[model samples]
Target chain A: MIEIQNLTKKYGQIVAVDNLNFTVERGEILGFLGPNGAGKSTTMNMITGYLPSTEGTVKVSGYDIAQEPNEVKKRIGYLPENPPLYTDLTVDEYLSFVSELKKVERSKREQQISDIMELLKITDVRKRLIRNLSKGYKQRVGFAQALIGNPEVLILDEPTVGLDPNQILEVRNVIKDLRKEHTIVFSTHIMQEVSAVCERIVIINKGKIVAVDTPENLSKAITKNSRFTIKIAGVKASVIGALKAIDGVKNVEVSDKVEEDVYEYIVDSDKQVDVRKPIFFAMAKLGFPILETKEEELGLEEIFRELTTKNIVVSTESDNSKQDASGEAPEEDDQAEEKEVE
Target chain B: MLSVYKKELRTYFYSPLAYVLSGIFVLVFGIYFLTQTMSKAGQGIAQIVFGGQLFFASFWLVMLIPILTMRVFAEERKNGTEVLLMTSPISVPQIVIGKFLAAFTVFLTMTALTAIFPIIISISGDLVISNTLSSYLGFVLLGASFVAFGLFTSSITESQIIAAVLGTVTLFFILLIDQLKTLVSGIFLKIINQLSLYEHYKQFVQSVISLKDIVFFVSLTGMFLVLVMIVIEKRRWSQG
Candidate 1:
């Protein structure tokens, strides 16, 4: 439903988004995963017609963003990192105003609002002023505003930020329910959110698209080297010597010495080798016993770090992190939440 | 536009900024009306209404322009609601127009309170109905133009104080250009004088509703509203 090409947003010397190209298919929930200052929100802003790209074209539902912003706007419900809300207006009044602004049919505006308030579990706070409502409720109200016209595409920027665990799950489930009808793209730093709601994942770093694939594939691709963490009750010197003798083990490094009797080590295995079994067998042969051993399967987080930490992908010549200043942006970007209001 | 109008009207009451502003307006509008009507040196009721719109009524717009305009795009940028509207199906023009009308509605309420001035005046002297109506119409158009200017200033900055200051400066210059206009003679001075808001405001005092004056007010409103639209467009491009 959305196609962004050569999209670059520059603030004078600093480029926020650089020569980015990606397409989000209709009915797919695309998770935009990036570290802080990865241009995820900038890309989202350009896509939703909130901010204009310095260069590049964004087409929403086949309409060019620059040429037909209103039509594109009609199709999108955008919740920025901070929910744009009028604190003074009651939740009912705020949603009603949004409904009218979105040009929802006069007769159905109330019904649509009621349904959304119910779906987002905000029925109780409907009558209260938005200022008095809690952050989560304000977010839901922001979501209600986005849903006012029932747009075909929903572009949410950090939708689940600042919520309690329960509220996060509630918001996630609501988004899952929304996927049946609308094309959804949400940007977030949360790893579980991407795995939970998105069918496709786009990992961005330094204002560029680093990799785009299914979450499973991205996780699997970055974790080819299997490392096992084994804690053995023995002298560190003997355990190190015994570990070096194992055939499947390519290299072993002492990760930490957890206790006086226990030595914690990370053992690397070359290509699909079942080194855990060998390590247990080897430790058994020696007087030292295997206290605890587990194959440390890397989570999505490691995969994300591998992709965003700089210069991980070697084969492709897509101009991504080359132009960026690298790592200097994270501190400034910690205020991503605050910058939304600026 | 209706949504904007309603929200803006509610903002005045909710923030009590409107009540405070209306209180100021009534004080000035009432004092002026009383001095003219109670003079009974036999100043016409039409004269008071006409004269009130000419000089004093617009002061309400002047002071109000800052408060009403301060929060337009600037506060949205502050609170982050500009994204909500910009990302919606609303066009730049619509955003500008909606906000302008909303502030204008607040201005309208302030002016409406001053309606009591004319009513109180009619109790003392002859009230020519057509002239009183023309004066009110002139006030509406002029108030609208100032609101448009205020909206334009708001769109240029995220700081409300900056927006308010820019609005005051822009309005003050427009109101006081007659002396400055003389530096550049003849046609230039005439054009500059005509461009002055207070200059056009004088036409309402004599009961003249010339098409030229109407065109000037309408063009002023349109031009400022268009400028606001352009400012918002450029801002999004720069920051989005």
Candidate 2:
């Protein structure tokens, strides 16, 4: 279990983490969500006893980080943003060193190391130098290092940042399995990873907590206006005019033709309106058959954008457009993989 | 502490640092031994073991100590391994002492290799065993102090080259203090002479084991190690 109270970190005049108060219970996986420079990593660094908080106290497993650092540190395992690896060492040597440093019992050290290596799937590269490993392997090695001592808490920063889709899924499943035994707090900008693995989500922006809730509740709470993308097999003008004439319809935007006769239109509806029934009846009367009609549910992506960028309209528009163009769900995973390859 | 000491000692052999440092050490000490032996001729093995040769070998320590210790902490910080070290269950003093002893062990091994010179002298001629033992004791104490200073330097800087330079310059000044005493007089001269690192070695070179000199070298080594601990403590606060 972990508790942070009125925690703050300042560098000169700038505050990196400002008055953050959150608690993570035992065996619960908490996803830390934020944009770049949102102090997600800073908060994690403070929680793990890696960086001392300037203003407040962090208590882990009933030990204060400032007053009893070694005891608190003994309970937490941290994988910093950049894995702290000695490239000159082979995988076995590096992990052995880590095991020793963490004071893992000598009798069980070999067993623990092998078990972690097998779990992360880095056993084949155990004898190779860490410097020669690919980015994904290096990330797993970092993960293995954090698991050496079997600490009660695991704090991972961007655990799946550079892995391919398969590797990401493997890491995700491994983390999901780990949740039964360890309290996990992992930070990431990727939205789907949070929804897939975390039990509770803490959304942070600009060194402050914006919202904290379950993923389903978060999406439902932030969505005010409902929009539907409806594809109709008819002329665009009559369909748009008819949909606009519906009472609950707020606005209509029609897209260019995909085929000769099929067209796409986005219909905006006021809150608590069942425009689907009205639009279906109106288009039915107009003889414009609806090809596809589905209500759009807000994903974590839209929720994140809405929470983080409350001031800049243009940038939020561009962010949404970029997300839409690339089909935001899988694009980040592919981009991180591509960057790793290059 | 034992685990960290073991890992550091093993790490030296895994890289070329330990071997390269020993190679340079043997080459330099070998040259000094042969030259001093040839010059002394038939004056006996005491001259070969306790005279100018041992004193001159201490000079090689200026270069050797820096090379051996420059990478101890600086390299760890650069590779980000310091995070792994600092966040572990071990305290800062344990880490520092572990690294310091490892470097000192390397220094002792190099000195042990040079012991063949005394053995050869004893076989071919009369050798004073007590004289050689005291001289070796003095050499160990001197090396301990130098290693401590170099380790302290390494802790304050992230760049190994800077650590090496700072260590060499600090040792160079300590070495120069013996000669600088000749230019002053009265109490000032006595104080400057007392500050010389080589001054404490004179009793051992004269085949006399004095308690004051032994305590001086030991306390000096302890003082530097304490300074290193303080620096590391300050780093923890400043890093926040």
Candidate 3:
């Protein structure tokens, strides 16, 4: 329901968000995964029409953000990184104010406000001044403010930053429930949040998109081989030799000895190849009994670290090479010394 | 725009600061009424309304307006709530005009309370109703212009203290520009004298509701309000 093309934001000499192009389909929950300063918030602000991009265009449901911002803004409910709140007002007062600002129909304003309060579980503290509420409560109130008009699009930045573990789970469930009605694009550095709630993930680093895919596909795409850990009732050398000799087996290494007779080995097979049937037949022929076997898949955390860290390493290596070529190599030597000290 | 106007109006009534400001506002006007009319019984009610007493009360306006308008935009920017307002479907001009009218309404309400002074004078002696009405008109126009100036200053910064300080200093200089006319000469002196903010009120206080004076205050208020809109609009372009 949203399309952004060549979105770039520059503050004088510093480019905050550079040529970001992405889209969110209707009713899709797209997770924006990035480290801090990855331009996630800047991109969101530009999409919500809060900040004008230096050179870009955002279209929300066929309306251009620059040309028809009012229509675009009417459809977006943005929860900024720092919840924008007037602390002097009560929770109910703030929500109603937001409802009015969002221009909810007069007949449905009260019902919408109460339903949002109920959804966020903030009804008990509705009468309390926002400044007096706890941080988690304040964050929930911010969420409620965004949900006031029941907008078609919800853009949340770090929706669960300071909440307790239970609250985080509650918020995730609420967002999942919201996905049935609204298209969502939320940003967070927490890998588990994306895996739990988002259907697709877009990983960004240093103002550029690094990868975009479903969580499962992202993890599977990171490595060329499918790994398997198997324990067999056989000598380690024979089991390793037999596993390596399989047609689809790429590599095998001894991992552990569970007992005097049983040994565990990690086996790597060619991509999209399943070695279980061949291993079982071969083991039967060799008189080796199989005890346990399980496939290993990469998790979101590993995929994220691999993607973000690779960019850092590549950039730093290029920087070091450039410094060496320029005869300004002492900085790299100093960095090496610092690394050694660590 | 209506939403912002109503929210700001409610904030004025809900905050204790507004009450304190209104109380001090009435007290200052009451003192001026007592000294300028009650102590001297022979002066016409028109004279009291048009006197140096009401003119000096404009000084109190220069001091009190910052309290009303300093937090209009500055507080929102500081607390980051400008995000909510700016991102709403409302345009920048709507936000500026909504806030300007809110502050001006509070100033108008405070000045309206001084109507009791004119009523008391009318009951006790011969009061020229036309002059009284005209003077009240002048006071409203003057207060509205000062509020516009304060709101303009508030829009330029995120610190309420700086907005208030700059607003007070700028209005104070405008209030004293008439005094500086004596130091200059010829056409320059006349131009500076005419530009004096308080000088415009002289015609209104004398029971003269000339279109020239009304246009002067209205245009001055409009000028500052337009500047505020420009400042807020520029912010959208420069911010990322």
Name every residue pair that clashes in candidate 3: none
Model 3 C-alpha lDDT per residue in residues A37-141, reported as the tens digit of each score: 667888888899988989979999999999999999999999998899999899988988898899999899999989988998999999999999999999999
Report the lDDT tens digits of candidate 2 across residue range B1-240: 888788788878888888888888878878877777776785643444544567678888998899889988888777767777777888989988998889899888888888877887887766777888888888889999999999989989999999999999989988888887778899988897677778888778777789988998999999989999898777655563
Any idea how many clashes model 2 has? 0
**lDDT of candidate 1 over B1-240, digit per residue (tens):** 667677766876789777887788788777766666567455432444445443666765776777777887888888988877777766677667777877887888888887776676577556667777888888888888888888888888889999998888778776668568658988888888777777787787568888988889999999988888887777776654
On the 0 to 100 scale, the lDDT of residue B166 in model 2 is 96
lDDT against true structure, model 3:
0.83
lDDT agreement of model 2 with the native: 0.82
Off by over 4 Å in 1: A229-243, A252-266, A272-294, A314-341, B40-54, B179-189
Candidate 2 docking band: medium
Best by TM-score: 2
TM-score of chain A of each: 0.81, 0.84, 0.86
CA lDDT, candidate 1, residue A197:
92
Candidate 2, chain B, TM-score (2 decimals): 0.94
Pairs with backbone N, CA or C atoms under 3 Å apart (clashes), candidate 1: A51-B240
TM-score of 2: 0.90
Stronger candidate by DockQ (1 vs 2) = 1
| TM-score of predicted structure 3 | 0.89
